[model samples]
Target: MTNFRIWAVGCIASFFLLGVSLAFISMNDQTQTTSGTDDLYEEIISNKAKYEKPAENAVIDKVWKKTPGIEGRAVDVQASYNKMKKDGVFNEKMLVYKRVKPDISLEDLPSSPIYRGHPDKNMVALLINVSWGEEYIPDMVKIFSKYHVKATFFIDGAFASKHKELVQMIEDEGHTIGSHGYLHKDMAQMSENQAEINMEKANEVLYALTNKKVKWLAPPSGSFTMNTVIAADKLGMETILWTVDTIDWKQPTKQVLLQRVLGKVHNGATILMHPTQVTVDSLPELIEQLKKNYRIGSVPTLLSENR
Candidate 1:
């Protein structure tokens, strides 16, 4: 064949191959989009209630005291189906929930010590009592900052008074500050009047530094009587305790501390820890692990009614 004829044949072959490839790509995309779409919306609507959960009301337990209400989950069948359709496949991630507010909220319940948030909420609060391990705080804050998590710190008035700048740095880092009493003394051993005075002094000191009134009080060593709770309520503050106690002051190894947390961790858990070498070593891994299953936030965030 002549040179021009050969060239024409080559051009024809290239165009044919390009057309075939484009047709195959379009067909494959169409197949993926339409695959498993039959009866998808019906399936979602039928199984919607199976996956849905109900709102739990705030309860004042004789032992657990004031427990916050949990916002319920209601499936949005239409939205879930639409999301799946957009993704061109079925995935559990495509599930959508509409929050169902509880009729009786935590505020409606009588005042008492709050130990944990709603058990069904997918969040946990880290309560770091600024005990004697002051040196480890900066490192803890750095880890929290790295993970974009916020925690609540309960500090003693004596420590806050001595290390004003350290306390201020904590508040500046966007962590919530709660009173850990004026002195590290056991408030349960004191009278209502004395406990009130101790709480007031701590509040006054903390307010002087942050210029923001503290609303939560975690009694030192979890030693507080019902009178102490009443005193805190009188001051417009809520008493808080913890669900998971790290007990790092006992000098548990880093592995043991993480194991304790992972073993006992649940929705709305209030993880209590102190600034210690073990905690600072365990914090980064703890936050990363919790983020996979639950959001790490402050006390107010965990107890909030919003989903």
Candidate 2:
């Protein structure tokens, strides 16, 4: 009878183990099925949300309007236009803003430096100040062309006046030319008439050299005044500021200069660099890293695209 009781106890234990195993298997199966269903439901919800979101109809409308000289309007165009108008295109204000008074002072210009961090896939523009080292102009052009990046060069009228051929070469290479002023004077201390004279002198030289209107201006020593801006604008110029100051004028080490520019560049940034040996040494690396981290575009392109 004791042996029989032992056998019966063993059978009961076996049965209990089997029951636990079966329960675990059932739970796991149910969990897997639930997880799969949840995944599918999430995908469906995401797609639904994507479809329900508003379309960029305004952008489409603008593109259509700007596309000039289309023959007859097609059904597709009308549909697209109507959809855009419904999507808040027609509701936008058509009023134009009055021109901002050109009252920025030379003192208002950035003297120390301006940089959030060197561009890392966020830098928008490079503001190049071209003066000195005219012998290296061709090499500079080649370097820019090799990297397929265009830069704005603030040419000193004195330099530009002497190197009309080089000035034309700069323009022929599809780069924007701007006035660095006739003699690189501080615009803040100058009278309004003097400022105007300075700008006119630079404009005359640049215009004569490149046969292109000088539309941008960068003050020497980053100095300027309300009168300066007014003078520039009166002569059809726009004031530009640097987001990254190279301090190449200070003759910093190439590594140090590279670090400063690489560490502080960001989108909508304007880099201030001079045509110096240190800058020349850093150019290859700067261009490579900038291309890797951000989209390198000409200053004019950046302004036009952003504006």
How many clashes does each candidate structure show, in the order listed?
Answer: 0, 17
- Model 1 Cα shift for residue 104 (angstroms): 1.4
Model 2 per-residue lDDT tens digits across residues 1-307 = 9999999999999999999999999999999866755554444334333223121111112211110011111123233333443333321132112222223322233222222222222446766676577877777788888888888888989988778888888899998888898777888899878988988898888888777888878888778766776777667566766667889879999899999988987765678887777887888899998887687766665544121
* Candidate 1 residue pairs in clash (backbone atoms < 3 Å): none
Residue 192 in model 1: lDDT: 83
lDDT string for model 1 (1-307, tens) is 6999999999999999999999999999888666657568777877788778888888998877898887789998878988887655556668999999889987788778998887778899999997577888889988888899999999998899999988998999999999999869898998888989999999999999999998999999999898898899889899999999998999999889999999999988999999999999899888888899999999999988766
Could you report the Cα RMSD, in angstroms, for every candidate shown? 9.7, 19.3
Candidate 1: regions farther than 4 A off: 1-52, 73-98
Residue 274 in candidate 2 has what lDDT? 78
Q: Give me the displacement of residue 61 in model 1, in angstroms.
A: 2.5
Note the Cα lDDT for every prediction shown.
0.89, 0.66
Candidate with best lDDT = 1
